[model samples]
Target: MASYHRVLEVFDRSVQDKTLECAYDLDPWDILIDDERWTGKIRLFGFVDIFFLICYSGEERFEKGIIIYKDNDSVRIILERARKNTTEYVVNRDALENEEIPKSYFSFEDDKGGLNYQILGLGHPIGLSTNYDPGSLKQYKIKIRRSDDLVTRKRMQRGLKQHTLIDLMLDVVRLGIITSAELISKVVTMTVAGSATDDLARKYLQVLSGGQPGTPGLSRDRM
Candidate 1:
């Protein structure tokens, strides 16, 4: 498996201004992390997760904490634990409901799904470009199947044994980097909790295209 390090792209003020990514396959860095944790939840509709982190702020060089984007009610335990490490921090959500969810929670927008990664943005971060998103005819079936395949794919890769491919995809979209089959494949393989499986990737692409593999015209093999 390939290893890569990414910066934390904070689109909202709710999150800290530090770069937050996985620690595996990372090169030695000057940044010092005081605390870090990862937790995930599986649901019928979709998955939910929390990553409570605290670190020495690179800008000021002092201890600071970070809160998950979840509602303060849902992340009370994590926030408490994280606070044990630092007094000053950015809690994405705390014991407040009416409180505005920091725009940091989401990234920029994408016309493809009409979903924003951060929140407000002019256009999609990673351009859909000339390529096409598997149309609606196959979107539902493909997303469900693809989401599952993603879970399996993350399991095969090393060091990425915690988050799902969707996490990587979200991060990429937030970063506004290029998103291609090769790029997505390489990065997802590096960060997910499982090993990379070409067969699984193909299965998802095929389903997305609404066509079976080994058939011509529906899907292309390369990015």
Candidate 2:
């Protein structure tokens, strides 16, 4: 259990800029910690310190993501541990406001080679929503209506697409078709055309290629 105060102090020093230090102001955002769901705003008093570290030494480092100071006398810190300068994190499920759908819903064989569209309802009739077995399919659906503002609609669309891609990657890993490292590499290749996964894909690529100084690596606790 790392102390929140220590984490904050180290983070403040890392930023160096006086204007970038944490002020402890609560700014709300939905975040996922490991497998648990948490809803809260960040406590950034000034500049948004979206990234920080709890510990770092000799090529081993633990990066902090969302720090939720719950009123229940407990603090939830999303951590990503990397050893020997590797780009991988220890727990890897960090997507804000996104729910994890069970991997069982995606059935695949080692030789299957790619996603099964029939099972995923990829070619289903346009007007009809695809339905999976009850209790088998669990995902967060972003309902966008015509009445939604432009920004809201765009955000929902981005979220929905990102959710779908994450599910696909998870399914690939779950089926043993590819290791998580391979999946990340594949995603980077696939996203060269550009998509919601571009930022993350690029990060993984940097890690795989031996990260440059000052570049952030992928966290196990991030999506």
lDDT (CA) for every model shown? 0.26, 0.28
- lDDT per residue for candidate 2 within 1-223, as digits (tens), equals 3444444443332335432323332212222223343333332322221222122222322223322111100001111111231112111234222456211211112112331111110100010111111112122211112212456433322222213457557656764667998888787876565343334322211112123454333221213
lDDT tens digits, residues 107-175, model 1?
Answer: 212223521111110111111122222221110000111112444333222111123457556655655
Per-prediction TM-score: 0.18, 0.19
lDDT of residue 100 for candidate 1: 55
- The 10-residue segment of model 2 with minimum total lDDT is 119-128
Clashes of 2: 6
- Candidate 2 lDDT (Cα, 0 to 1): 0.28
Which candidate number maximizes TM-score?
2
Model 2 pairs whose backbones collide:
23-45, 27-41, 28-41, 92-220, 94-221, 94-223
Best by lDDT: 2
